[model samples]
Target: IATRGLVDLPIDVLIRIAVRLPRVEAVARLACTCRDLHSPAFFEAAMRERTARRGGEVPLPSGRRRRETMVQALCRGERRDRFQRQNKIAAGDYHSVFVSEEGRLMTCGTHSFRDNPQPILGHSELDDEDLQVIGGDSVLVVPRPVAGLADVRVRTVATGYAHTLAVSEAGAVYSFGLGESGGLGHGNEADQHTPRVIESLRGVRAVAASGGLNHSLVLSAAGEVYSFGAGDRGQIGHDPESLFVPSRDRQEVTERLQLTPRVIDSLQGVRVVAVAAGAYHSLLLSEAQHVYSLGGGGATRRSSSRGRTSRFTGPQWTPQINEALRKVNVVAVSGGLGYSLVLSEQRHVYAFGNGSHGELGNGRDHSSTLYEFTSDGLQQINARIRAQQRALATTDAFGRHGYEVFRHSMTLADEAVPRLIESLGGVRVVGISAGGSMQTGGTGHSLVLSDEGEVYSFGCNGYGELGRNFDNESEELPTSVPHVVETLRGTRVVEIAAGGASSLAATATGAAYGWGRSECTGLREQVGERKSATPLRFADLELAHG
Candidate 1:
């Protein structure tokens, strides 16, 4: 039939032929030559064949609109995947943790670099002989599996500023890394270089766990919640009357140590099912689909309550069932820096807190509210700190970096209450994740997974956390990253995570992809200098023998 003409057969038959072709280039050439197969439908069907290659291990997305947008992207040849994925992924400030189906764990990136080197990679740095000092900074270019935990099967993992947590299938919790603020939950504030079970909660089966910048939360199989670490802003859900955390700056400093995991009595009989955290706040979900809020501190120092001042320059929000989300039927929640995301059972996304960098995804940012300071040494500098300059959106005043922050002129606005994202009204969202920190461009970003397995991102693109495919200039602009992640439209993302300035996605076929603000994550000098990243293979694998 092809000998006579490419269009001699039905379009469906032509599509089947194009999909079986081994090379994407071959499919591209054929689509160009045969006008009938050049359209989005044909391209989508062909690319979708990738799922069949996985032996139907994962299902296709459930939304037609998502399928169409994803296929259109595949037709444009925007995909570039070549590896498989792990069972689970947990992203943090500058590093990540991966748990494989084989019950093994691996981690990359670190919290320490030059002056005082620390091994927060869940492995030893001394064992790595070939570690390079590029541009006078130590850099971790690749991921390595952790050594311990050969006997236990890890089901989930979480990462914090300088620590890591692993929950075994047996519901046992293991922690490692920095011990400051009693983050390890071991009764003492001492760093654990290796995994150690929290002897205190050995009897209670922990079902889920989450970490904050300086605090942590744990949930029991029976619906009880436990919290520890710093509670200066009430992150450690304990009685305010008995709460006490050391704070040199605040005259109201408490005389108590936030050392061990204690049950949050307020959530008693509440049947809490899930937990999420950010730099200075935490969120809880009840079995009844109710959302709970706790802590509130970040980049902006504005107080939600008049004349009230707390740490991070705001009045602290105590743990309480959010009245606004009382009837929203929230299924999941995630937070970062000063903002939070709620995924409702109705496939709607609600955001609140900070919107200075567009983290809200409502098509509006605090650009209109930026206040400039004419202070000395406050030069126009890129907060993303890229090696090369991308397009710069006009702003009234630059942010604080090497200069004194108060000397810089800027204002961060708060959304105050959870509101539905009107722009995403048409898409059926299945998952939502948020990531951030105090970066020059606000660093907060949000990610949503459509029912069709497509990813949409908004907020700060200063660090490439949005992960938009730049194949077409019109579709993606680095200066203003779009909402939908076109590069991932074709892949059925089964898992996704957002960190301080990075994003991770795992496909239905078990392949993983990541992109975000890589500028000096405070661990590696080279990683901090943002640029189109592609580390030499040999260098990444040189110390692979370790």
Candidate 2:
């Protein structure tokens, strides 16, 4: 058949030949080889067949219109194959990172050149001159491979306010960027412009890691949790005694900082399977399906008999089990600046603390309503209701009026305890992501991906982070972002992430979509800009075909 005139073959035979080719690019290139075989119908059929075989939408051969693959739909503006190799994505307050299927890493967003000043250094065989800084001081508007890590096979990445951490396949952790407050786990308060291995964790195999504004957490293969960085608010999980000694002056530990990684002995016995970090708190999920929380007074505050707020303190501080989460086994957890979310074994989601921006997803705004009623006002309302009840005909009237008053009073109250997000009931939530913080001046938001491949976002949409089109408003209930749903209609969302005021979703086909806060680097626009509330497909990278 090769020796014969290939163009003379039957259309059916030609399609079979094209289908057998190893790559879509190959088939595309073949279509351009000769006019005899150049048929729009043939090309379209070949692409449709290839897409169908790869689990993509396939149109009917007769009368039905074809559906676009997530890739095709997202690659509209500029046609490039860079996104074809992306497998995972992480977003930070002002930057984003992408991990390719082959372990290559690419980053976009805000990065400082003042620290390094020099070109990025690495062990790649390529010459130093080859690794030049494209644009100095300007925000990286597109995803570009990090030079120094060219040889490092990155498995996952986590971004902080202004820093980045990457875990390699061998469990080696590399950190870079703002090291202030020790968020880099490098045992020093020095900024790093190039990727540097955290010498303290050199031999320790880290299975997972997360970064907060001024702190970092790493989970080892042995299930131990190591934390480093600022501990002023106990974000480092160190014992209070170790951090400050008894003093008659009773001075506050104003310089509370951990310059190196320290293991949290309190978690020694528990086999932690996952870890998450907020701006000032940390969450751990153990193998036994128990959730543990440490640090930050906002999320875990106890009112003492004296009516003063007391916080849990210690090195290996006894982690508080979210008491509101009883009977339900938690499988995953995420934290925002002052709020937390946990996914139960049954896929039910429970949220606690700070509903200020509706991050709690409980249909209330605590920021504006928390102080609406003072103690005196509540007493006055109770007195008026009691007086009114005395004049009522039956006790039922008082009961109904009292219930209404109670409901109204609690409407805007902060969820100091875990409360089931009733709006998400009946939807089997498989994953949860929370974003924004005081550090970034973001209103904060939350996102959850359902088992049915749908994503629901709520909370602050001030910058269109929720992908809801409208901005400056908040959604107290979980609402689906119609544009995102319609854009990637047939794709299954495998993972979801939330940044300062941005959201990202990765599909089963390795397609990645990002929306909100254009400064995060995932968007094509410049810093301080905003994009459509709908997710824009990443044009730089895509998952490589199997």
Candidate 3:
């Protein structure tokens, strides 16, 4: 293998062929060719005799971890063997990147440059460019797809902080690039990298678009949910500078700037499936499994004896329904930058806001919001002593099923409600996701997703995204990556999503997996800063391999 000699092997087979070689930056340039294997005590006695002959673990040989998980399984098999390429890509450090698949739109990267990745300017499948104009370019840029919106087929895509939302397949809705506070609804504050069409929505089956350093959220498909750019901390419930809108019939609409699309009248029939956007606040998920919140009314509650005060602020124009979730049915909702999470369908999980770095798995501290009264505080005190001895007869009789919650975070200050992530006890949680990976030494974390797709990480692995390989260090809490994904262990994982730092999983045989921090998840040139990831498969699905 490499001309027979090369140090005549057997240093525990050269540390299992040097931990699957090639990386460690081409083996530190192949140990600087000589000087007795580049000093440093022969590379610390070959990692202390290969961590004392693997007791610390380093086996490979599952055909070399399937050829090093084939570089993210050949980039998800060439993005599902091309036909249109682009499976999914996300970014928010302003490095943009909102790519979706097959029936596309595209943008390149450049939140603030880090050496070449440029490919913006698109959207024009023709018809006199009816709706094109993607984005400008930034480093290495590579997005490219949007040409007149290729019949606007799209499946799902969301991005805020410069506007961009697409969700068509009859569920029609579209917008492109910046619209100031109106976030591109087209009525005023101008800016449109070209898609358009939000004709006040039509039937809207399912959609989610989010934002907060300004304001934005768009949830529809009957369950109603909507908001438009910057509402100060009212997060768009209205009145901080007018972009005011709130009327799925709940009607509030004022101060002017809704540029378009309105409906959230306190979520009428409720239906909403999912919607998350924070930096101020906004989260919604209800199919009966309720969870409705609206922008940082001063970040919510906190008295620990008056160290913080908004007097547990309230009234961001209204839409608060969290009363510690009545009976728990909500099924999936997420948000970041300030904190929020809810996933229930008996997979129970609830976290109010700001648990600092613990991201609300409830390790305590760091301001909590106003949804307290945690997870049925002992099943609501045992359903009020079984309804005062009438012996409670089935409201699902204290129903408690496969509880689960994937990932979360909130504390930047102010929290009054929401908290029930009891440190993941009983482990049935399906999936929760968060982001902002890579910042080692300074600590800046967030990443969670489980349903056995396993991958729990706590804030800022610096860049290793808490994959735990020690790229620097920063994990204030939440760290479960005990490696049982033996290529997705017993299968399951229906879906999962995360960003800011990166994490993803999908199964039930559709196959998809991800690691952390690197161009968010285009795999920064195939696994460069994945601090602790192991489930790197990325997709090969036709459903067979267990």
Candidate 4:
């Protein structure tokens, strides 16, 4: 079949078939093999999925040509599997989650040592109660049920170090696991074994939940925000010294409860759209499309020649709006251990906080304490860097700006100032997530999802985070997955997140999938000793869309 001439399939039919093949590289090969396959019809199908409105008139495609464009793009791009309609992922350290459009959730990676790892509802349908068990060193998957979660039905879920929280159709909050520092919102010191409602909050419509090493945050539907858990280093956006702490007596038990979810005083009027938590920091995307940060405030007051600038750096007990994003509208937000990623509706991506392993997706190799780079514009900068080899200039101790020769190119270190990532350009990115310090193959890399549901990975792939099928090969730039995701070639993905060393993607249909480090891949049995290069579809995920 490889050498055969075009199979005489109808162009639209052929385009549909092309979109289903596992990976964009396969589509490219198809186009290369047959002249008829290269027709405009095929190209149109590939491109349509990436777009929402033609002529900005409606949400659906305008005609057959537009549909063909969507199909052809899937064949032409490097990450064709991501553009397909049947795949989604949910990732984290030691464990990952996958929610399918069918309404089922599948998990893999590290299992809790206290109990054997199994699908959250694989043994039986989930009842109203939640479950808890000790965590493990490797990845484990957990797929809980929403049988009686609430009237609204569970729309999303979030996990923390030892806790889990979910949002319902009625806009209420349900949480379980370690309640230390009020992570469970029980209003007192108590670990929850079942789903419990957070009574303090009402009249909510949407919620964004996030967890840290031991802390957590919940952004309410009304744009108000609440936080709890270990406040050490102010992970809860409250004074660490004021929150609960262990007593000097060995027998004493600290409640570690916040008692109630409090509205971040300064953020009250600013409606929040999204929230992300790291080991000790948190980021919130506001209704205004602005990014705000809290906890782990550091010395980010760098005096640039343009102005005396002060930005969020280290431990903070209060929320502060990201000054750099004040002028831009944020469409998406994601993070790993200590960094954050913001994708603007305009297709611009800005990374801040940490960049130790290049999780920031910037092309630098330093730690950024503040706004560092605009990633979406990387293509232009890489082009310029290729044209010139001029050394980076420096300024004096007085903070005066001047040009001087210095060191190497920026890789993925955290930037005190926003530095434009000059590698990913022209390509429209819809989602992005960060993983841990594990450098599987690349020097530094980040996983990104496109508007068409396609996935692209850059930075490090030493553990197959790049989905390249190798653990020793690391890249310094975004590398599109060459093949279509065989399991989910026609699914639509809504968002993606990375945890510890694995990755997770959620579909508009509610399905999810995972890949990467075994302990964090959310699987029961390890795939082998090697990190997973391609995403594995968990059988239990088929239940979500049901």
How well does each candidate superpose onto the true structure, as a TM-score?
0.68, 0.67, 0.31, 0.62
Model 1, 363-453: lDDT tens digits are 6664444335443322333332222222122221112122234333333344555768878888988778877754344457788888888
Q: For candidate 3, what is the total of clashing residue pairs?
A: 63
lDDT of 3 by residue, 1-546 (tens): 458766665555655665555344444455566556655444444544433342222222221223443333222222211111112433443333433434455543332233322212323222322221212212322344566567877656666534567766566767766566576565666666567776666555544565543456776544467776655445556554444543345433232345565665655545554677755567665543345676552233322322332244433555556755655555566666556666665565666554434445555332222222357553563464334321111111010111111012123322455545666656666556543321221122344456555545554333444454442322323332222234445766555544554455555555555554444333442423322344454322221112
Output the number of the TM-score-best candidate: 1
lDDT values for all models: 0.61, 0.62, 0.46, 0.50
Cα displacement (Å) at residue 486, model 3: 19
- RMSD (Cα, Å) of candidate 4? 14.3
Residue 108 Cα positional deviation in candidate 1, in Å, after optimal superposition: 0.6
RMSD (Å) per prediction? 13.2, 16.0, 20.8, 14.3
Error in Å for residue 541 of model 1: 14
The predicted structure with the larger lDDT, 1 or 4, is 1
Deviation in angstroms for 420 in model 2? Answer: 1.0
lDDT of 4 by residue, 393-417 (tens): 1211000122111111233344554
lDDT of 2 by residue, 1-546 (tens): 357777777778888888788876677688878875556556666666665554333322211214644333222101111111222677777677778767777776654353433111111223333222323333455567788788999877787767788888899989887777778877777887779999989899976788887788887866678888877666667875575322236443354677778898776556665788877678886654556787653444432333333332222245655545634567678877656788876778887755555677777653233323678975665465344321111111011123223322322424656778888877877778877634333356788888778888877665567776543433322232212345445768878888887788887777778887665643634434444476788785774222
After superposing candidate 3, which stretches have Cα over 4 Å from the reference? 1-148, 151-156, 159-164, 167-184, 188-233, 236-294, 298-310, 314-333, 336-339, 342-350, 353-420, 425-448, 454-489, 492-494, 497-505, 508-546
**Model 4 ranges off by over 4 Å:** 1-89, 98-111, 114-152, 188-190, 202-206, 239-242, 248-259, 297-314, 366-412, 437-445, 459-462, 471-492, 507-511, 524-530, 543-546
Q: Where in model 2 is the C-alpha error above 4 Å?
A: 1-87, 112-137, 244-253, 302-317, 372-413, 439-442, 471-487, 522-529, 544-546
